[model samples]
Target: MSPRAQPRGKLANWGSSFLPGAYAGSYVNIGSMKPDAVIADLKNGSLNRSEQRKQADLLAKLNRGFLARREKDAQIEAGIEAMEMAFRMQFSVPDVFDISKESQATRDLYGDSEYAKGCLIARRLVERGVRTVQLSHSIDGYDIAWDTGHGDIKGGHARLAKACDQGIAALLKDLKTRGLLDETLVVWGGEFGRAPTSEGKNGRDHDHYGFTVWMAGGGVKPGYSYGATDMFGCSAVENRVHVHDLHATILNQMGLDHEQLTYRYSGRDYRLTDVHGKVVKDVIA
Candidate 1:
């Protein structure tokens, strides 16, 4: 999941928080509302600690009416569950982000960029048994991180590529050395690719029809390339994978059937791959 893509509303914790009788939710994030800051909060009782309990109490009180009426409320239950998960995470998550505990050689392997730091952090998170982690790189005062917009693609892409290349390489190496790669899936790519045809000056626009996503470990064929675009890379000409198809393939690799795994929401059956999606078996090891 992209930090830029997270919904900043009540549904924000939908993916990170799993509720009873809910579907498809995962682990908590470090430094998230109070990720990595839990210890300090507990020590001082600063806003997050004292204030959190107050909020939890208020929510329980509000939800009491629904419970008294013999009715179930999903939103209230989800919020309470999320709060408990966040509080419990403080114990295990803080150390996961502390890359300073890593060896000097390991630090050098990831490079010095901010993105590199994140790569190292991600590895640490995984090592500590965090199943999923998402890193989003951004430069202050800039709206876009990797999207090279209507600016200098040469300068922008080069810097981005350097940071990503070093970080990704180190992550793979570190995971393999630690014997975590085979079980941990590392996915690298963005929502879309840049258009080959620059709409203006020296920059291109977003191109979703044709893009690339790379996968490693977790039973994928190592050093293999799948699918292809046309000469101009304008559209996916061969073995095109839609977003839904991609979801299905990923779930399949994770040992789940996209079609079989369904969640009930709003009194309707909802599949992760939506209406149609099939596993691309070619990419599997």
Candidate 2:
């Protein structure tokens, strides 16, 4: 099964009393509420909470208002205002909004696609002081997405590879150009790689035994490939980096000792790497 993108579900709980400058739809957690009840609450201004709950409530109310109005001419205007407020609360900005369109040259450089846009946006967000930015290669648009084995492995991998190559290359180049590559880590990979063998009808099943992932900058050794897979790419043959090892490596980059970063839970010290993890010394710069 494909891992869930986010464990928190569709509703994100900001839980902060203060509103942020910007927010995504994923930032609000609206529990069960009937249309009538939602409308009544919004009209009464009972949705405001002292903490982050207010942010969630605001989003819920805005959505309810939009639906209640169902005004053909007023829909766009209403949504625009809601977005302005939502962005202000989520991102902590007073009135900043993304209004400019990408130029032809910029679009061409980034491949003129959503995935590319996402990669480019990641750089922008991080440059603006966002702690972390993740660019997920989702299976949308582009007839040939990952999960190559399902139909034409070659076709899917080709599309995915091209997009990744262009998008990742652009990100690295931009980060380097801005001198952010040294501190900004870029990871490219999937949960697992496709199987080496073909299914009965030309599809490939999930194989967790071995896969490929890449990391650039953030003090990671450059042009260096770590670990190896067997001839069939079915099993890790050398320098195996388990999922825990990856976690430990990430923690080490952030200046936290994997063994020392622990939380007491259930009367036991729980760590990100659990009881297993080495610093992955060879990969560190």
Best lDDT among the predictions, by candidate number: 1
On residues 5-42, what C-alpha lDDT tens digit does candidate 1 reach at each position? 32233244345333352332433322232335423443
Clash number by candidate, in order = 2, 16
lDDT of 2: 0.62
Position 89, candidate 2: lDDT: 47
The C-alpha stretches of model 1 lying farther than 4 A from their native spots are 1-71, 141-143
Candidate 1 clashing pairs, residues 3+ apart or interchain: 31-35, 32-35
253: Cα error in model 1, Å: 1.3
- Which residue segments of model 2 deviate by more than 4 Å? 1-104, 141-145
lDDT of candidate 2 over 138-249, digit per residue (tens): 4443222475767777777777677657867888988998899999888777678888898767678788999988889999999998889999989998999998899899
